[model samples]
Target: MRRPLLPPTLALVFALWPSTGCHLLLDGEPAAGIGAPCEQDSQCQAAQCIDEVCASPCSTSAECPAPATCTMAGLCQLPLRAAFVHVGDPATEQWTQAHEIGRQAAHEALPYLQTEIATNKLLASDAASAIDDFVARGFPVIIATSPTLRDVAALKSAEHPGVKFLTCGARSSATSNNIAYSGRMYQAAYLAGFAAARRSATDRLGMVASLPTPSVVRYINAFTTGARRASPAALVEVRWIGFWHDTLPPDAQGKTRERVLTEALLASGCDVIAHQADNGIPVATVAAASLTAKAIGNNVEDACRDDATSCLGATYFRWGPLYTQLLDGIHRSRWPAATLVELGMTLNPAHSTVNFTLNAGSGSSELAIEISNLLQELAAEGGETVPFLGPLCSTGQRDLDADGTPDCLDPGQAPDPQELQRMCWFVEGLVEKQDPADPTSEDRPALVPTTGDCAR
Candidate 1:
């Protein structure tokens, strides 16, 4: 993580220095005032087109507008410095890796954009210094890729009104200068579950899950719901590893907990395994243990790239376009405050936010065919092939309506966005675990959904 290198006074001086670039004007008329569209210096009133914008010449930071710094080129420019903070090593963790890809893509799309990253910011406290350091270094935009940093992002946004901040996976309402954004990944999860079930001969699907976070639970529920849709007899057994990264200590057998749990699931007749964990350990474990068993990847495309033969595609998020759009809005200063931007297949015209990928070697099995078909259906514009429709029930069989039944939803009904974000219950097809320590345990127990697990 980055540390504060310059004192407050010196930092402020550097922040206002030539580390930023100008933003474009809205008008297209030639020789328009600063902030108007321009091609060359002749088209701008200020006689400069710096950073693809009509820019006012400035000798010092004092002559520039607030948050716009005087560049070395003697032009007033908005701070184009942006930083991305990740929870783990992006090289090893698929979730963080996705954001890194986004950051690169954004930079490539906007060459004037300056970007940096701080890794291993797993907590708010860990991320706070990194964010402050970036701010002090003249980064006017901070993109935290983990939900754990949302509170700190909120605090910092209020402290630095000139700086824009964004946090991932946060359902909270955005405030001035800070917005919480997330992708609707459950849609892809449903398709992955359906594929897993279709590929399974025993109709037994296993999931190595991390924390029972609302988002994770929603993914699990959607996965199970999809599996049941494909094969009514399908039962998804979950093994909670308790940590998003699953860096738990290895057992006496010299195996990581994720590997042990994955092997156990395979041993218990689970022909296909899926994971909601941060890393691709489940896919790796399955690839090494069973020749026939397949695993589903999460968060990144080609997650099973290392073990494609043992993999059954993946549900991944492509953050490039979304990041590009958000950064572009910030660059143009058109972003609205206190707004929540939830991108998904239906919302984004490209349908690229939440996506699925199938291995080319998956062959012509029923699973592969169905996955291809579902992908086509989902890719269609304004399609209604959603996964979380009605006729569903919770794991505990709790009554959602007063009709004296355990059904959570009636036929043809769909869960709202808020409900999906705050989902805390699993679907009816989730097999209850007998013992928390035993990943393969099948003994039934009374399970209930509560709000505690929904807290981020």
Candidate 2:
């Protein structure tokens, strides 16, 4: 027996309907057309429907319009023109601010280069995904700002040998066409320490830190050593904040800790405070400003907005020129594949952008002069000053290897990479080390100079 003829409306709807495509429903019947509500198979003109949305079936680039490719994510996307990307944490607004300056300079220097910035609290997986996405889009260069993302970059570089990756503030053991590593902040930090020492009043100093990582530890030691060189009677006390990414509560807590530490040091006669802590400046500055008796400022020269203040100058990092240099390298194809690039306060060779700043007040002009001289000496010597190498010893009779030979100062002596990597002892004359287990200690780590070099 023949089936009864379907209604004209139903028949028309079914004819245009797709078996598994997106469609629109009209007048209680299935519909098939663009911009129509759709469901499974019998509802749309296209066989593929997604959440009532209809589109042409696409399995590859040929199935899509020109310049569009079916992404693995199952969507058509425009082809990416840039070949490089940079990832940074937006939370590190201060640090990233400097980096963005460099990015801008880079763009200016290399008008033809393209770059994309990704900001987030990057995880290893997130880094992997970012690299994968970039690679899939034909990007050949990736720059990561945080140390934590280094490993992922290394892994991705290994997986894709043709890609090039650069990491700032991260050191890696792996070497490949895809990786370049550098962390030259130590040079700047050493100079800043000298500036801090030249500005102290009581000769007792304070340093606030964000973590005990090698980079931070190195800066702390260098600062303390520099202070000692300027004022033998100077004592540097350090507090570790235990975190790199500054947070509000802990940051405030670090400030509180700085206040308490400064008070204790002041009670014991400390008059100046400096810090290696990222974003610890606000807290340290506030504490310094709050003090009725002492001077305050950290990395940058402390130039208080108020005239009647004792805020010394501060040391500021400028990243814009450096970024521009890298971009230039990429554009000119002069970028070294596996070399570590170190950028400093010196003018950028390609763009002449200065990447360092100091904010010493007029009262600290003498200190600034001394610091400038020291920097010049260091630069003249090709960055060869080692503050801790000296006829040095701790206050506690920690004699230098029993022969009275200074650990760091003997010619040709340098700390072992491993020891330098895990420094924990406080230098002689410093007040305290932030105890990892002690809640009472500041959230930052303290560093002190030691009396031994490479057993030379």
Candidate 3:
């Protein structure tokens, strides 16, 4: 329920700046480069002409002109000196990839921002130490992108009241001077669901989630709901891989839960699948090779160089606007202490919401357009109410528990955050097991609405 804190005075300043002119710098310095125009690499000393601008060579501290340092990529980049830490399981290349999008955007939007990536192993000691290291480094804004990092962020926010924290897939009530939470991801996930529904061949789908946390739950529910609305015949199976990290050893029961569940769903005739396998490349490749099924791409798909026919399309999360907006706030010296920012489908031409990559040699432009239109309509409805709600039932026969009234309607009476965090049961029509030995089980129940509830 976090709201935007945009003051009228600050809004006016934002209105005046050219749409693309909001860049954050330490002392009003330009982000790209300094000095007069140049045409070639050798036009200026220690500077290369990139895109017609004279910029310094980048590789390391020595490569940079002054004050700037070299990063892990061997690029001479502006040193924000402010540590932007993203904590998640790097093993799941997908989550890592999604966060990388935000990191790249932040780096480009605010030239002074430095970043660090950490993996959460669920060990309390490791989590505590990670927070300590970030604070010790004097990182101003620490972005926790995973559920496991939520408690860590909260604990650290209390200890270091001067540092600012932002979480992506999780939320917390830690409204300390140094901590703020935002859940704009529901918008992204909803869009992803829309994309999945469009590409489904059987109108039967599946979702593999990392954990039952609020962030993941909301995404799963929203996706299934969206799919049902778009294609009532579409059945979405929801599964949980209890662990966020994708590379965990199979539970001692000798059953790789995620793999087993996924195989089961494929055996049961699901054509399209979307899962929170942070490292979706492997899963996508496997699904493509194993089940003759199609995969809905996410962050990693943008950088995919492979010829994956199963990759029908992907849902991309563009964090550039948010970063640019925050940087603008900081530069104008009017940054709000505690604010919630939501970036969805807007008039900004730079934002990329859902990207549909057609199968090679398949003329599917018409289909893609149809899908895009549906997504836009759903997005227009906003996040307060998901597309799937009425007459809902899970395969488990868990009553579509509404007290004779839909849970989404009736303002201020929505499901509590705690309920969302603990969501485990799948909606009706899915064919996944409730208990699986593998912590990363992919088996899930398909979600469908009751007759007369979903749009035809």
Candidate 4:
């Protein structure tokens, strides 16, 4: 049946309107093929639009058209689909940004492995929904980039037995199909601590920290232990900001919680400041807070790169190798065994997952040489000279094991992996201030600085 013609203005409006619910163009030139440009799956005959191009789902190269090999993501054109679950703003959060950088690198290195990121998944339910969506879309790999999402990933992994899951910085016990991995970041923190202590004239240091989690506690303990080796008189004062990233409302002075907390630490007479939080705000605040004070950074190298003179050094993570290894495993059909791996220099000597960078402009050449020697010693076989070695006592001197002995590690005795994984106590010489109003008040942990020789 012939339809009636519309008015000129109405005809132009209909012509300009975007076509939807159909894969054919107005001219009816067949259907958009795999190489055709598309904005959505509905616009393509293949029903898959990836990276702005029509793609056909394929499990192997034989299933794809000639000259187009199948990617690990089961797509003819795009690579394997890997998704990273983020809790904070990657642009503003250093930790999440670091993982994002790694994601980009992994995509670059393994063209067969494509990547996607889902942000603002602050709650377990939010992350679970995102993960489920990714799984429904045939994403084979999921990397939960926060400890908070560790349990969420675990439960999802159990539900999706074929999918591989990796949880970063989680101390949880490994499950049958989930891989728990974290870098040995405390080693780098120890190095940064030594540099900070060497640059401090008053032997008083400050650290802006988040919650007292096991990983955070390990970093603080290693840093304090390193500082004490450099200066026995070193005393570390800690301020808890109660979050992994800065998100608090501005104060009356228009300063953020990070800045306000740093100022309070500076007011307490700390000469050098360090931070375990996931941003450079604390470091930048130190630059503006005082002319003589210094800062040590964490989780990223930009701290020293941004202000070499003001920042002594920083402990950073390089996740590229780890991600590459995992993705390549999928490519080779050699998925990693489900277990917990604490990757360190001992395991990754070629390119460490964790590293420390120093600013030569801020410290003397002697200090650099000392740090280099210390790093070599630490990297040597068995970690005998590691900073966590004892004759160490808690600042509060509470009995940890309840065996009627003070919670002190005797000389030549080192903390086992299980004990370190659950450490919530501080070593001696730390001036821990507890604010009942803080979110981390339930965990009243402290830091410690050693006196005299720890070997004694």
Candidate 5:
């Protein structure tokens, strides 16, 4: 079992230098400027365009790191501040990337911010208490991650409206100082699907997901949708482990189950596989499998040392730019509690919040290079890369409009913001359909003895 954190860890007191780039921002959001569409990834100032937006990379500091500020023009360079506090540890792959590494990356860009990194038990009350402690200590910007903290975060934000609070995986009312935002991973996931599909020998692809929520739903749908678009006849298979960051039980069982799922997929003839869960067990599984197959990682950009050089890279983020944006908003224009910001990817190399990386070694192959180039083109601005929209089918039960009737989307239609955020259905093109009534169909629980589990 992981040991409890004894004290607040002040990870570092580093200075930040702004990322060098020119960007266009509208009310602090990335916008395409009058510049000609970028011809390649490196041509852009902000290393973004992962979403095909031919604009400056970031709209705010959350996209870049601290000490680095994102200007209204979408540049991440003016010096910036505390004011930031991150709660969570690196014990689990998901938490590590989301909190540990996320903090470091954000700070690297926003160097002026005096940030605090704290870890508590995997419980909401504990998280809330930690935030309370930080609030007492005068940390005005509190970035609280973890499902356990979602509800309490809303309450705490209300209790201390003077404080800037942020939450993930859930929404806060639009009337408070608290705001919620999520990574638009589906955009990158679609690219991964397309890459995996192109490399498949059997046209069978397997994916291991974290949970059944809309985020995971979007990831799965985008992936399969992209795979099908590329391979045409490829089959996308999926499995789940029943929770997010299952660090309870403190045993290898959770990990073992994750691997078994991969083995089962491979055994069933999947030649290319992807894993989108938090702990990144799939990286190890896909890397270690004796069978030769293409593997993809999600969420974290860095290669796993345990499986160095084995992965095709991963879909990653730079929360510093985005977080930096939130801080600026709070200091300048106070946000009502329930603000929502949905950021997509751009093709800037250093500043893209979302990026697709392939192993340098594997990328040398003609096919690997081909996949890499294809991703670049697809992610390039002004391309036909809407993997989640139109001519779709639903793999899970869905009620997009919430009318008395539920329906699968037909051709010429797409899942809207509500549908995507709610993520009640999967896009068409799975190897097999699943029961909407299945317990594992939606929401997973945590491993520890928590008061609530997303457990279906």
Candidate 6:
């Protein structure tokens, strides 16, 4: 059927209307897409728009126009189909904290998109299956929570080259799609130790741990360093429970494993206790119920808020904003291959991925204020002045660098990130203990078991 012709003015307006969407041209307005601003995904030619600016994905800077450089994810905007995977229930502390934070971030940042939290028991096979489901759904970005999923993440990365697998507590820093994401918890640990030392009446700090990986080792060593700085007589003791968590009960000795270790440390006059496992509740409980001991716990967002007086402060994990960046890359369709995110307060405490929260109490009263000032110094000037300086001595009073000079004397010798991550040595002040022989020889061990997580 032929349509009737419009008047001259109406005909001119129709000719100038945007072809992308059936909308009449507005006065002094540029059309959506084709290098123009956009409000949402539906308004762009690329089906992706962020921050009121349309992203044009490209490989090289030359391909991107001025003021828009090629991002780390290789895209101009974040991806749409982003999902988070965890081994534990969403309510669990360390294993599922990312799920809670991810949900919050998605609601605010990617509200138009539906973000999923795929929960599983997280054995090797289960991890593989979870990745398969996400891949089938065409999710370009996956943020894995538990360290137990490392091997599974690697295998799936090989299977699906397009997926970006960002993980916390990863065992390795592989340069492939299995991106490594870690917060400088040692920086926070240093603050926690100083706080503990200030609170300790016995001048001792103890740690109940699951594994002795470099990450864990770094935490213990940094705590020891900070504690010593606060109190010259301060000492640190560590005991690993033979696993990452309290997954197993004790033998015929009526030991819950944790009870046994806590009793032993307290008997030895250890006044402050910390745990490196998932939830900080147990640590808080142990400290509150103890006779003279206090607690320094982690993942406090999930554990310590209820009982503020049980211990000193919590070494909080800040993964939400970090996880948001991974989603941003996924939406932009440009995941970088070999990126390692090592965030610290030195970058900006207001925006740091980790920190300590010590409420005022007689145990940690003015010490918390002192530690806060120390943190400001630690975070200043790129944070090179961290406590594990060289001319540094090891557990046996031997020079850590194996040279005649110590870190304190050298001034140029401080443990760097990789050095701290690979540290297996204890500092000078810690008491000699029955840990793995030659700790320096084995800085990082298997973060998870090969057949664990019910892998059939």
Off by over 4 Å in 5: 1-88, 91-95, 172-174, 248-255, 331-338, 363-386, 399-406, 432-456
Better-scoring candidate (lDDT), 1 or 2: 1
Q: Candidate 3 or 6, higher TM-score?
A: 6
TM-scores of the candidates are 0.81, 0.64, 0.66, 0.77, 0.70, 0.74
Regions of candidate 3 where Cα sits further than 4 Å from its true position: 1-80, 88-92, 116-122, 178-201, 250-256, 285-291, 301-307, 336-339, 347-349, 352-363, 379-385, 389-456
Report the lDDT tens digits of candidate 2 across residue range 1-456: 123121121111111212321212234322234333345545444334443333344567566444444545343333323333334443444455545666666565443345777666356876788778878877766777666666777777778876667777655437555434443455566665565666666676766666556566666666677777777777776655445544445334454444444445444444566555444444344444455443433322222334235555454555555555454344323344434554333422232222123553334566666766666655543333445564554444233466764344345455554555454444565666456334345423233333222112
Better of 2 and 5 by TM-score: 5
Stretches off by above 4 angstroms in model 4 are 1-79, 346-350, 382-385, 403-405, 433-456
Please list the C-alpha lDDT of all candidates, in the order they appear: 0.72, 0.50, 0.51, 0.72, 0.58, 0.61
* Ten-residue stretch with the least lDDT total in model 2: 6-15
After best superposition, candidate 1 residue 59: deviation in angstroms?
20
For model 1, the run of ten residues with the poorest summed lDDT:
8-17
The residue-level lDDT of candidate 1 at 50 comes to 56
Q: What 10-residue stretch in candidate 3 is worst by lDDT?
A: 15-24
Candidate 4 lowest-lDDT run of ten: 8-17
Global lDDT for candidate 5?
0.58
Candidate 2: global Cα-lDDT? 0.50
Model 1: CA > 4 A from native: 1-79, 346-351, 365-369, 376-385, 397-407, 436-452
lDDT of 6 by residue, 1-456 (tens): 112211121111111112222112233333224233456666666434545445555676565444344555454332255667778775665646644764575456443244677785567787777779988987766767777777778777777866667776675645366777777788888888888888888886777766656677677778887898889888776766766666775658855676667666665667888777765544645654685677776864435556566666777766655555555434333344445666665434435567777754634346655876887877775444466776666653224466765334255477666666566556766663434343333222122112232121
Off by over 4 Å in 6: 1-52, 55-79, 171-175, 250-255, 336-338, 346-350, 360-365, 382-385, 396-409, 432-456
